[model samples]
Target: MSTTFWIILAGAIATYLTRVGGHLVISRFENIHPRVEAGLNAVPAAVLTTLVAPAVLGAGPAEWAALVVTALVSLRGGLMSMFLAGAAVLIIARQFVG
Candidate 1:
């Protein structure tokens, strides 16, 4: 096999072994700390918020204006209204800016 093929195969095997080994080792633990468990439970929500917050808020003035409009629309109308606001803002921005 080529060197690249061997490297990829090794990486895949290593990842599989690490994941399986982790599960095996974790199963042996009798008790998980309550704080750690709580933190773990919160991790997914935190990650999702981190992922989405930036996309919703990160931008220049035009983007911020659109986000504001969307938020207002969302509060008054619904998701579709919010989407329409964002799309309308983007179209308006493109027309004016570029």
Candidate 2:
């Protein structure tokens, strides 16, 4: 009924359709070329960099410290561990550094 509900519903439908379309297209392909495979593999990293670059570039000292801690934890741990490590570092930095 509300505009926000419609917008959310449309976004969900678009996301679902995009995912299904991608799977359908991939399934039809018998074999992927090496170059295409490499490109596909690089997509996640590229998207992650695009998402994080702005925040890392513009953030305050606390956020910068959190990013460093998160990167270090990510090297040896899973996503949850990395997230917790980053959050903890941010909290500590905010309290003591700010």
Candidate 3:
């Protein structure tokens, strides 16, 4: 195999092992404390914020407007709705602003 193939194979194996290891470790815990459970529940949101913050901070007015629309729509709708609303707003805003 080429070096690229070997690198991809190694990455796949590493990703699989980490996923399985996390599942195994988590499954062993019979009863999680309330605080720990709450923290775990917040992890997804925290991760999403961390991933999005930098882009949002560096974005232009149109992007910021889209984000505002996204937040408003998110309050009254599900994830898909929020995403669509944000995308539509961004597209429209970009046409006018950019």
Angstrom error at residue 75, model 1: 1.1
* 1-98: candidate 3 lDDT, tens digit per residue: 89999999999999999879867978999888899889989988998999999999899999999999999998999999999999999999999999
lDDT by residue for model 2 (1-98), tens: 99999999999999999889878989999999999999989999998899999978889999999999999999999999999999999999999878
Q: Which pairs of residues clash in candidate 3, taking residues 3 or more apart in a chain or in different chains?
A: none
What is the lDDT, from 0 to 100, of the residue 96 in candidate 1? 71
Q: Best by TM-score, which number?
A: 2
lDDT, candidate 1, 1-61, per-residue tens: 8999999999999989977985797698998889978887897789878976877665666
RMSD of 3: 2.5
Which ranges of candidate 2 are over 4 A from the true structure?
none
- Ranked by TM-score, the better of candidates 1 and 2 is 2
TM-score of each: 0.46, 0.86, 0.75
Instruction: Report, for every candidate in turn, its global Cα lDDT versus the true structure.
Output: 0.81, 0.94, 0.93
Error of 2 at 58 (Å): 0.6
Report the number of clashing residue pairs per model: 0, 0, 0
